[model samples]
Target: MRLELLYFFFYSMTVYILETNGWPQQGKHELRWNHSYTGINKPSNPIDKEVLEEFYHSTAGPAWLNNAHWLSGDPCESKWYGVGCNPSGDVVELDLSNNLLAGELPDRLSNMKNLEVLILRHNAISGTISPLLFTMKALRVIDLSYNKLSGSFPPQIELPFLTNLSLSNNQLEGYLPNHWNCLNLEVISISSNMLQGVLPNGLSTLSSLKYFDVSENFFIGPFPKEYSSLTSLETMWLFTNRFNNSIIPESWNKLVKMKNFQADSLAGNLPELIGVNWSDLEVLIVVDGHLTGDIPESFCHLKKLKYLHLFRNSLSGPLPKCFCDLPTSSLVSINLSYNQITGTVPDCFDNFRDLRYFYMENNNLTGTLPRSLSACKHLYTIDVSNNYLVGSIPSLYANLKDTLNWFELDNNRLNEIEDGLEDFIVTLSTKFCSLYGNPWSCPLPNYFSGKEYCTARCSSCNTLEQHSSCEKCLTSTSNCGWCADGRNCLEGYTNGPYYPYHCDQSEWVFGNKTNC
Candidate 1:
C-alpha cells in the first residue's frame, strides 16, 4: 500500500508541472486526468465556480470577442479573460467593456458576492437589470452605459461602498429609485433615459455626491430644493425635460463648487446669487425658459466662465457694461439671441482674445457695429441680423477675413461698406453672408448683381404708409425718415433724401437722432 501511494503522488506532481509550464500536449493529458479533481485547480468555494460558468453560458460565452480560456479551465487558476479574482479565489472584477458582449445579464451574477467593479459599458446587453445584482455588498463601481437596458431603476439600493454608477444612453423608463441609501456614492448619471416624476428629496442626504445628470427625460415638477445640500456637486445637467413652470431653486446658490450647470424650459429669472457664489462656474445654459429680468451684472464676477447661453427667453434691458470685466482668457461663446434685450453691442470685446462666436440676433438693439469687435482675431461667426444697426461696415472687419465664416448683417439699417473691405465682404458673401435689407450707397462688387445676391442692392427706399410716428418711421426701413416741418415721411439717407421730395435737410430726423 505504501509503494502504491508513493507512485500516485509522483504522477500527480509531474502532471501539475507539465500543465503549468505551457507543455500543451502533456497539459491536455493532465487536464483529462484531473478533469474531476477539485483540489488546487478550482475555486476554493464551489459556488463561485458555478456562478462564473453560469454567467459565461448565459451571456453567450463562445460569442464574446475575447473569450480566451473561459469554461475550459479554472476561472481564477487559469486566468480567464476579463475576469479578476481576490486572493481567496472570489471573483472581484469583471471589465468587459466594448468587448462585443451581447445578451442579458444573468441573474446568477449576484453570486459574485465579492465583486468590487463591474464595467460592461458600450455593449449590446439588453433587458431589465436584475435587482439581485445590487445586493452585492462589495461593489464599488458599476458602469453599464450605452446599452439597451430598459424598465425602471431597481427599487432599493443599499450599497455602502458604491462610488460610481452610470446608466446613461439607455432605454430605461419609469421614476428613479427613491430608496437608494448609498451614503458614500459620489457619481450617479442616468441621463438620456425616459425616467419621470419629481426628483427625490432623499438625494439631499448624499453629501458626498459630486456629479448628477438626469437630462433628456420626462421629469416634471419643481427641482428638489433639498439637493442644494449636495455642496460637493461639480456638474449638473437637467436640460430637455418637462419641468414645466419649475424655477431653479434659490437654495442652489449654496452649491458653490459648481463648474457646469444647464437646464431648459424652466420659469423665473436667473438668480443673482449664482453669479455671486459660483466663482468657479465655467458653463451656464438656461435657454427656452420663461426667464425675465436683466442679466445680473454680478455675472461679470464669474472669471472662469467659458460659455454663456441665455437665448429664447423674455429677458430685456441692456447687457451690463461691466461685462468688459469678464475674464478675457476664458470666454469662448456667447448666444443671447431671440430676446427683447435693447442696447448697443458692447464695444468691450477688445480684451476677448479667445472669443469665437458672437450671436445676438433678433433683438431690439440699435447702434453702429462696434469697431472694437475686430480686436478678436480668432472670431469665426458674427451674427447681428434683424436689428436696427446702421452705419458703414467697419473697415477693420477686413482683419478677420481668414477666420470669419458666417457674417450675417441682414435686415438691418446698414448703408455702406468701409472703403478697403470689398474683398473681405466678397469672401464672406461667398460663405454665409447676408446683406439684404440694407440700402447701400458705396458700390459693391459686381457679384452682388447676381440673381442669388439680387437683394443686395442700392435702390431708393419705397415710401410706406405705416410710418405713423418718427420712431416707427426710422425702423420701417433703412432709408425712410421723418420730416418734422410738415410731419411727412420720406425716403432719405442720413445726409438727405435721394429725391429732395418735400423734406428740408434741417427738418430731417433719422438714423440715431430721435428729435422728430
Candidate 2:
C-alpha cells in the first residue's frame, strides 16, 4: 500500500506538470519563457491595460472560457486560450473565434505593441470600430466577422501592413470609408449589411484585391464603371441585392479571370455581352432579374458553364435546344420556369444524362412528352405544368422509376398515361406523379384513396369516359339490335356512365347522344 501511494503521488505530479507550461518530463527540466519584447516590467499604460483586459475578458478572451486562470501563478507559462505570446511574454496572436464574447472593444488591445494577428469572429462584440486603434501599424490581419458589431466605419485610418479583412455578417451600415485604399488587401467580404450609396470609385486601384463580395444590401443606382480596372479580380458576388442598374459598359467581357458569376436579381436583360472568351465561366445565374427576350443561341459559346439558372423572367421563344448539349460532367440544376417559353421540349435534352433537376413549366410547349425522356439516365424531377402538351405518357420509367421523384404536369392535356405511370406515382405517393387537366378515360389507382376522381377532369368536362364490354362487340358471341331511327341510343361500351341504354335529346353531346 505504501508503494502504491508513492506511485500515485508521482503520477499526479507528472500529470499536473504536463498540463501546465514547461519542458519535457525526461527526468524533470523546467522550460523557460523567452520575451521577444524590448523591455521588462515597464509601467502599465492605462489605455493599453484596458484594451488588454477587455480582450482577456471578451468572448475572444480566456477568462470566461474554462474559467481557469490561464495567466495564474506566472506569465511565462504555456500558450493561453485564444492567445499566443512571444518568448518575452508579449501577446502576438489572439484568436478568440466562436466564443460568446459580449461587449465593446477594450482600448488596451492597441497596447500589445508586438501583436500581429487578432481574430474575434463569431462573437457578440458590439460598438463602433475604434479609429485610434490603427496606430499599431504592425498589425497584419483582422477578422471580426459574424458578430453583432454595429455603426459606420471611420475614415482616414490606414493600416499599411493589413492584408486580410473580413467584417461580413455584421450590422455595419453607412457608406464605406474612402481614401483608405488598402492596396495590399487580398480578401474583403462586407456581405449581409445595410450599406448603401454608390461603391467608392478608385477601388480598382487596389490591384492586389482578389475576393470582393458586397452582396445582400440596399445599394442602388448605376453599376460602378471603375470596377473594370480590376484586372486581377477573380470571384465577384453581387447576388440578392437592389443593385438595380444595368450590367455596366459592354466591355464587361474584360473580366477574364472571373469564375462564379451570380447577378441573379441584377436588373436588365443579358446583353450580347455573351459569346466572348469567358472561358472560366462556371456558374452564370442571371436569373430572377428583369431579363427579357429569348436566350441567345450564342449561349452555346460558353463551354464551361456548369450551372445556369435563367428562370423567373419575361424570357420568350423556344428554349435554346442546345442548352443541355454541353459536356454532361458538371451540370447541376436548370430552372427556366414562369416565363413565356414555347415550342416542343428539345430532343437535345437526351444528352443531359447527368441532369438532376430540369424545370421548364408554365410554357406553350405543345405535342406529347418526348419518348427520349426515358434516355435521361440521371434525371430526378421534371416540371412541365401549364403547357399545351397532349397525348398519353409513355411507359418511360425503367430508368427513372427507382430514382425519379416529382413528375408534375398539372395543366397539360394528359389523361390515359400508361398503367406504369399510375402505379409508379401511386407507389411513390409523396415523391412522384400528378395529372390535373387532361380529359380521357383514366381510372384512379387503388393507392389514391378518399377521392374518387381528379376534380380537374370530372367538374369541367362534364363527361365520365370508361371502357366496358358492349352488347355487340366485333368478336363477342352476342347479337345486338341497332334500331337506327327514332328514340335510339348511340353505340358505346357495355360498361359506360350508364348500365341500361337511354337517350335524352336535351343534354345530347359527344359521339352522337351516347347512352350508358
Candidate 3:
C-alpha cells in the first residue's frame, strides 16, 4: 500500500490545514480568504469577515429577530445566528440575546478579537460603551443588560477575563472604576443605573466575588469596611442607594458567605454581628433606613432565615423573644412596618410552619391578639394595624380560614369578638376586613350589621346626637356613652340605647372615656 497511501494523504492534509488556517503558530495562515476555499466560502479571518460585516451593518441586521446565517457565508461556517466559533474559526460566542438588536455598539466590536461570550441582552442597543469594547482581552460574559446604554463607567476597566458583568437597565451615568481589575469577577450587576460615587474599596479585591448588585444607583459613601474582604460574597444588593449615612459595617461580620442582603437608604444598627455570622443568611432587607436599636437577639442564629424586611426603621425594643428560636420551617415574609416597635406579638407563633406575609404595621404593639397566630398555616397578609392592641379578636383566628388574605385590625384598643371569630370575620372582603377603631358592644354585633361590615365607626354609634363634650362623646364612638349629666351621646354602658331620663347611672362614662 503505497506507504499507507502516503500516510493517508498526510493526515488529510493536516486536517485541512488545521481546519482552514489556524494553529500555524496562530499566524492564522496569513489571514486566508482569496477564493475557492469552501468551508462555506469566507471568513477564515478576513478580520472575521470584516467584523461580521460590521456587526451586520452596525446592529440593524435587517431589523434582526434572528437573521440566521447572516450575510450569507462563513460566519463560523455559515451558522451565524448569534455566531459562536472557536475550533479555531475564532469568534467565540456572541449570543444575540432577545435578538431584537437595534443599533449602536460597533467600534467594529473590537474586531471580535477572539471574544468570549458577549451577549447583547434584551437588545435595543443604543450608544456609548465602546472604548473599543474594552480592548478585548478575551472577555468572559459581558451582558449588556436591558440595553439603551448611556455613557460613563469605562474610565479604564481592564476585564482580565471578566466573569459575568451585567450592565443592568441602562442609561448609565458616571463614576465607578475607581479601580477593579476584574480578577475573575463573579457577577457584578450594575443596577438600575445612574451610577454615582463611593463604594469601590476596590471591591474588596474581588476574591472571586459572588453576585454584587449596585442597586438603584446614586450611591454615596461609607459602607465599605473594605467589604470585609468579600470572602466569596453571596448576593448583595445595596438598594435604592444614597448611602449618605452609611453604617452597616460591623466589619460585615466577616460575611460568612452571606446569602441575600438588601439595603435601602442606609444608616444602620442591624448588625448584631449579623446574627451570629450570617449562617448562610437568606434574605434580610433593611428598609427606609435610619435604623435604631434592639432587634438582635443574635437573630436566633438565623438557621436559614427566609425573608425578613425591617421597614421604615427607628426600631425599638421587645418583639425578639429570640424570635421564638427562628427556623420555623424557614419563615416566609415578616415585615416590621413603620417601626417604633414596642412589646408583645411574640407568642412564639407555634412553630410558624412557613408563615406567609405578616406585617406589624405602625408599631407600638401591645398585648392581646396572639393565639399563637393559629400556627400560621400559610397565612397571607395579616397586618397588625395602628397598634396599642387590647384584647379580643383572636378566637384562634378561625385557624386562618383557609389561608387568610389581608385581615388588618384597624386602629386598635379592641374590645371584643371572640366566639368562633364571627364566622371568620364574616368571610372577609369588606375591602379585606379592616375593622375600624374598636370598643364594640352596642347591640352592634350581628357580624357588625353589614354596612359592608365595620367602620362608619361600626354603623355610626347609635346615631350620635347630644355630645356637649367628654371629648365629643368619646370621640363619637367606641359605642358612644358619655353623659356627665346630659352630655348625652349614649349608645351603651348603664344599658344605654339612648339612656338619659335625666342622666344618672352614677354619671356614666364608658370605654376609653375622654375625661368627664
User: Top model by TM-score, which number?
Assistant: 1
RMSD in Å for all candidates: 17.2, 16.0, 22.4
lDDT of 2 at 287: 53
User: lDDT, candidate 2, residue 180?
Assistant: 60
Q: Which stretches of candidate 2 lie over 4 Å from their true place?
A: 1-51, 58-69, 73-76, 85-90, 133-136, 350-353, 370-380, 444-516
Best by lDDT: 1
Candidate-wise lDDT, in order = 0.75, 0.58, 0.72
Better of 1 and 3 by lDDT: 1
- The per-residue C-alpha lDDT of model 3 at residue 471 equals 67
**What is the alpha-carbon lDDT for the whole of candidate 3?**
0.72
Candidate 2 residue-wise lDDT, 1-516, digit = tens = 974563344334323423332322211211122323432333333343445655655544543544243544322243345555555556666676766777888765677776767777777888876665666676767777777877777765477777767777788888876666566877667777778787777566667776677777666656667777776676676765676645645666667776656554455566655646455766665655667778877677676665566666678888676655565665555667767888777655566666666777766677678777677777776778777676666777545777677777776655445656655555445565666654433344443446522232322122222212222222222222122211122233333212122223342333322432
Ordered list by lDDT, greatest first = 1, 3, 2
| C-alpha TM-score for every candidate | 0.80, 0.73, 0.35
Which 10-residue window in model 3 sums to the lowest lDDT? 25-34
* Candidate 3 per-residue lDDT over residues 1-516, each given as its tens digit: 974463344334333422432222111111111222224323456687788788888889998888987887678777777776666677767777788888897787787788877877777999887767777889877888788989887665788898888888888898887677888988888888898988778778888988888887898877888888888988788776688567887887887998778776666678777788887887777776788888988888888887777777789988777778888887677887878999888777888888777878788887788888888888776888787776577788888877786788787655557677666776775438786755443455566664656351432443323334566567665766665543435467544434112245677777665456
